[model samples]
Target chain A: MNDPAGAPALSEIAIKPLKHVNGAAHRWVAFIVMVAFFALAPTFIYPVFLMKVMCFALFACAFNLLLGYVGLLSFGHAMFLGIAGYAAAYVAKEGLNIEAIRLGTIHIPLNIALPPFTPELAILTGVLAAAILGYVAGLLAIRRQGIYFAMITLALAQMVYFFCLQAPFTGGEDGIQAVPRGKLFGVIDLSDVKAMYATVFVIFIGGFLVIFRIIHSPFGQVMKAIRENEPRATSLGYDTDRYKLIAFVLSATLAGLAGATNALVFQLAALNAVHWTMSGEVVLMTLVGGLGTVFGPVVGVLAVLGMENYLAQLGAWVTIVQGAIFVICVLTFRRGIVGELARWIKKPL
Target chain B: MTDDYVLETRELTKEFKGFVAVNKVNLKVRRGTIHALIGPNGAGKTTCFNLLTQFLPPTRGRIFYKAKEITGSKPSAIARMGLVRSFQISAVFPHLSVLENVRLALQRKRGGSFDFWRSERILNALDDRARELIASVGLSEFEQTIAVELPYGRKRALEIATTLALDPEVMLLDEPTAGMTHEDVGRISALIRRVAQNRTVLMVEHNLSVVADLCDHITVLARGEILAEGDYATVSRNPEVVQAYMGKGYA
Candidate 1:
């Protein structure tokens, strides 16, 4: 039997239909709430610690972009963090106000052009570098999926750690210290910690917004399709690999944004920035916060960073605690804090 | 009418090591006919389907759809050309709601595929298309159900409905009635007939009765070679077809 020629359209029904699997009003409300918290946080907490929290929160958020949205678990995100940190630190501290005067067949100026590099320039460089590295790393990591993908990232991160340790530009084990925060457009004094904190907050929020937009977009649908079934996505005429690679680069660029901010905020870029442990830390943050939810990483970063602030004197006990939390998350809290709460509320967090 | 034949394979051959899975196969499917490819197990039915759809590249020959050669084309490219193949088993987004799964496919079908900013509108629009597809496939009652949560027969029906969301000119279904109960089979058979009214359908089925009842023509394949080809009555009585099914003719 043929379908009726003129029927009431499927669009004109009782229910308007859920436009998105994740609710729009809920997400918008969440964004407003997050902005309110970010605005009020400085008044209640120490500015430096709050700044540090903001930096790590941004870092964790960037890390979550790959793991949560794309369903890719990365273990070497620290490469982007560390590389960008060192690069920004080096540019701010030594490279910015250098001289080029003639010295024994080498023309180096005595008074270098003091056109001080802006924060925007530093962050842009950081994003570009991270995207490039991510392109290369993702090409290799995406060749294998699931647990194998994690292992490949972990191994590559170890290689980066060793490279940073041996490379003289990175200052070997000492790293580049006394990194100047530099000007916010060659005008604002970044030494004013409040201004710096505001700057970091803006970058973090901007990066977060871009990520939110992406995950909610049509491009994001392809990613979910790839995550669910790559073969079927391919059969549906989607270039799945390119989508994965783009996701990887986007995640890395945001991670680099966090790294550049970290370098500026602390006035130092250390070997610890690139270490495998740092990579593991971000994974722990995402896991404890929520693996797939939007605001999960922020919660995760705040929790982990808060613990670190109090337990800094506990030495290796912090590592032990972090490991325990990871185990707990894997075995008991597969949904993480936010994920479980969302389930209880019967709404997406 | 030249463009109406949605799928055509010319001397398509697939060889794995020394074994030929599909050999010198030429297939022509009209734009809106439920073309059934019925054969015994291992008659290269699956392989031929795969080759025509470019799941596996043919060692020899080419495939054309809508007057365009599709040899060596990627599966996604072929699908984008309005030809989509559903696996024998159910293929669906299990974690997503039935409406969401269909909407995703509809989003892909529309040119608004890359627009992340406007997905909300597109997905909203797709619900109507999804509902129509669901109703067409006799799944209107379960429109909001999760695909994986559905019963086995229902899941298969959902898979077909999901494929329809692509608005394909030609649909390749491998064993659309496999492992189905008698009632379920009859329902699916009717649905298939309805869908085939306006779209080309190429399916492989072991259920001979379903073939006899639904198919416009029959192609019998034995050991990767065409054994018989004609209407159901002619092919069913062909000596080679009887020999392949029964193992030997009775004296």
Candidate 2:
């Protein structure tokens, strides 16, 4: 059948992905099972720790949406993470309330004021702000090639870092501490650790599912096409730059969602989350899991953060251990843990 | 319909610093005719194609497709106007399967190009048309094969099929047979003739035999200017055209 003795008639070709019922059904099953695991995991493990993993997993997945799908690299993605964190914290705690920002010795009393926001609204504000910033930054990053990715990323990173540090509502270097979990949607009291965990879990699962949907969509096909070879895509009438920018913005928005959730969960939005190193950390997480695979980033978050949690007793030796694990993983399963698994299973995941 | 030409260039010129790549060359591709742009190395044949496609903007020129001025149009905009092109290198999306590679072009037929939220399975509606195109190009057997895994000659075939899926009224092929094997060349030449039955073709070709066999009109370029333009017999008989483009072996 593979031999081309004669061409198959127009009606002869059988539809594949659409009709591949087992793969589609199994994928849904896998998703449901994942939801069950996360739902039940808090019973056996610390809710806060799991929340941390979910936040990072969501962030890594968002980053992967750009890096893996569209072949874009955001060197300063931490800007999105940090900016969103600040926005969420600011909205939740102050909501345009310009109290005072302490800079070393000077205290600047600010009069900027707006009504306080609900938790979900605060998160929405962060995500939207991130999306806007991503759009501006993405405008500067060329659609094809990684040469501009580093340049644009660094520029945005510096600008965002300063904004996060100096903004009066952000509490400067101290960040917005003791942010009230507040009532989620004027109903659920997130002060309960389990309730907070559930909210964060919802965010993680939602972001993960969205990213998954985008990748498997027709939009995803074009993104992959651009990634495979952009010139070809351009020739085929695709406004490649627009697609890339949209992908970049979407990636940043999701990352913002993660950061906003993290800020709420810990009741703190620190300057550290917005720092350049945070961006580097997300890249590491995604690479460790699998750069392009769907579950790769989540798996990577599990490995990296889990190792940190489990190896804290070793202190400085943990770095050595972590470095060794990364080295071994790179040498052995270069495609990443989930990437290698996806390959073994012969699935697009 | 006012002009006999489907695609035309008026004084199309491109320069790299002080050196001129394409020097005020006028090109007219008649509708429903196979037009070939033949030239030697560095004769600006590819540059001319690039300018016509707006991939490389000309220093000074005007391009007209279907009698409308398209000088300021973007490469994609021009492509959207039914003037599609193939690259000197095979231009199919390498990681996508042949079916997908073709279906992507067909996706343009249905609107909502940026519908990121919808499932790609909806694109399955286009599989039949994509398969028909694949079969037309003798690639029905490789519909599921990843483009990168295809044999070199077959990759070009896949590209043609992908290009055809765009449903262009005018096709620009930049050395469609570049670096192809002799047998592959013969196969692609016949394929080109077959596909060009209805559409106008403007091609930059190195192979003289293919130009003579398939092209109704030939334009010879050398040192960034048109050396000659006519039927194959007339152009090949020109001593200057032979010396500049065809070489002594052909003469």
- Residues A14-75 of candidate 1: C-alpha lDDT, one tens digit per residue: 12136444455766787888888888888988788878877888888888878776678888
All DockQ scores: 0.38, 0.51
DockQ of candidate 2 relative to the true structure: 0.51
All candidates' lDDT scores? 0.78, 0.84
Q: Which stretches of candidate 2 lie over 4 Å from their true place?
A: A1-20, A98-113, B245-251
lDDT of 2 at A180: 91
Across residues B150-189, which tens digit of lDDT does each residue of candidate 1 receive? 8878888888888887878888888988998999899889
What is the DockQ (computed on Cα atoms) for candidate 1?
0.38
True contacts kept of each: 0.49, 0.61
Clashes of 1: 7
Q: Which residues of candidate 1, in runs, are more than 4 Å off?
A: A1-33, A43-46, A96-116, A151-159, A166-168, B1-6, B17-19, B109-112, B117-119, B242-251
Candidate 1 chain A weakest ten by summed lDDT: A1-10
